[model samples]
Target: MGATINLLVMASMPIAKVLLLAAIGSFLGLDHVNILGEDARHHLNKVVFYVFNPALVTSTLAKTITFESFLTLWFMPVNIFITYLLGSILGWVLIKITKAPRHLKGLIIGACSAGNLGKLPLIIVPAMCREKGSPFGDVDVCQSYGLAYASLSMALGNFYMWLYTYNIIRIFSRDVIDDANHPEVGDESFGNNTEFLLKPTEYSLMTPNNKIPMSSKFQQLLSQFSGKINLKPLFSPSTIGVLVGFMIGLIPPLRKLLIGNDAPLHVIQDSAYMLGDATIPTITLILGANLLLGLKGSQIQFRIVIGIVATRYILLPLLGILIIRGAIRGGILKCDPLFQFILLLQYAVPPAMNISTMTELFGNGQSEYSVILLWTYGLAAVALTLWSTIFLWLVAS
Candidate 1:
């Protein structure tokens, strides 16, 4: 009983921190205050994405990642990808059952697919580690390693979230706004030459062309796939930071120059660390600001909202436990409890904030996305605390 109470109390403190920051954000976003308004939050998000996040990921990865860490944590990226995959499958089912609108299909799928892997975990892990009853032992050591995990989570999360969710929303918008709902759009209207990628079957499906050779047609399909993915996301600053961090960590001479005591360029790491420190508060505030938009008056469907919450909070977390435990039983993961705890927490957090940005960019379901974020974040206080307790107790036991 005493231990249970201690763990619950430990869990509650971090919940309070997140809630308090979110409240402050909501207040700032009010029309009267207009301090952290939508435009303001959008710009703040850009700063977090382009500046603070990369700095944090680069610095943390440099300081904590080693060749051994890579080998031990190989399951993470795959695990995160699986989380997205499962959420997508769940979302598709929800959409079918709910009879959702065409424009909103991608939004539902994206919301369920991308957890708030980066921002929430970064704050939650360190705060949990810092608690008195913390199972991870040694505050400084726990925080150092925890931050590294969170940073890499953020980096990889950005990669998947942007590449997959962003495009999903964009494609759905084209379907609803231009293709079916609006009017048949000419392929020439698409400025980026991306329209052809969307309807790869329009040529073949609409008209069977026997004159096309199999190998030559296969080459055309390959080029279209390549064009759609584009190299831009792979070369995003955050992704680049991960690559650079890995290079610095893996190479001895580079590590000697920038990392550890007695290093020549140690000051550069300090600069990045200082900048990265600003990421959490700013993101949490932006999250709150965005949710405020949803709470006041939202136009989204009730079933859509409920579907997302169920998929993210209940289904994905359950799936996370099974996958991580199997990895453990299969000897795929190390016997580090803290590491296991981090992996489980990935499935339990709120939807990624970038989903909101993507909705706004595509001019489809932005308000609905905000509403989904509102409730998910509102419930995160309770849901995350419960999951954290279970995860902590499970690993500790």
Candidate 2:
């Protein structure tokens, strides 16, 4: 009982910090306060998105990652994918059960599928490791590796969130826009538009009179290939930051030059670190301000909110335990206990804060998503504390 209480206290500290920051944000965003009002939040979000996030990704990954660490943490990507698959299935079910509106269905799925693999774990793991009586030995060593694991998790989470959940929200929300614009046509017009986007130029290998030349056919094939692939998401600022970080971290010469105190160019990395430090607080503040909209009474359904909270907190964590433990039993995951714990923690986090940004970008479900986030994150302190305690006990034992 003493051990459990100790673990619970350790777990709750990071969550408490997050809530405190968000509380300040919420307070500032109030009509009477207005420091973090809608306009202020919008501008701050731009700064965080364009500046802070990329800097954080680049500095953290460059500092923590190396060729060896990459090999050791190979299975993490697979584990994250499994969480997305399971959560997505649950999200789909919730959408159907609630009969969520077209605009909100994507938000629902986005919330379920994209866990907050970035900020929360980055905050929680290192903080827990520093606490008294941490299950992982030697505070310094534990915190160092824990930060690395969390950084890599953030990088990969950004990759998946942008490519997968971003597109889902974009497509669904666009459909809603199309329907509104052309109420009589419905999906047919949208389908045609999508087809047009995918295959803008029709390719012909044959004509009524003669078969097309191989050279022309090659060009046609190239067009089709390029048309189907949307690489815009791949080049997002955060994604580019990840790629740059990987380049610096994986190559010993580059890593040594940029990352270490002895290196001549270490100032670059230090600058990045300074900028990156603002990411968590700025994001948390924006989240709090967004929640103000939810408090103002949005059209979101109670059942949808409850369903997402249950799926994310209850069903996902239990399934994550089974998957992580089963992998250990089967000898597929032979990493250190801290790494295992991070994998488990990934499943147990709140939805990605990026989901709200996506909805805002697409002009759909901004208020609804804010409401969903408010409930999930409001309850997150308890949920994460409970699951973190269980995960700590499981891994430590």
Please report the candidate that would top TM-score against the real structure: 1
Over the stretch 1-397, how does candidate 2's per-residue lDDT look in tens digits? Answer: 8888888888888788878888999999999999998889888988987898889888877787788777878898898899889989999999889988767888899899899997888778878888888878899888767876787788789888877888778778776776777676545413444323334344344556756576766776576445434557756777788888889999889988998899989999999989988887888777777777766668988999999999999999999999999999999887477999999999999999888888878888888887888889889989998999899889888
What TM-score against the true fold does each predicted structure earn? Answer: 0.90, 0.87
RMSD of each: 3.9, 4.3
Question: Model 1: residues >4 Å from true position, as ranges?
Answer: 180-231
Winning candidate number (lDDT): 1
Cα lDDT computed for each candidate against the true fold: 0.83, 0.83
Model 1 lDDT tens row, 372-396: 8878888899999999988988888
Candidate 2: what lDDT? 0.83
TM-score of 2: 0.87
Off by over 4 Å in 2: 181-230
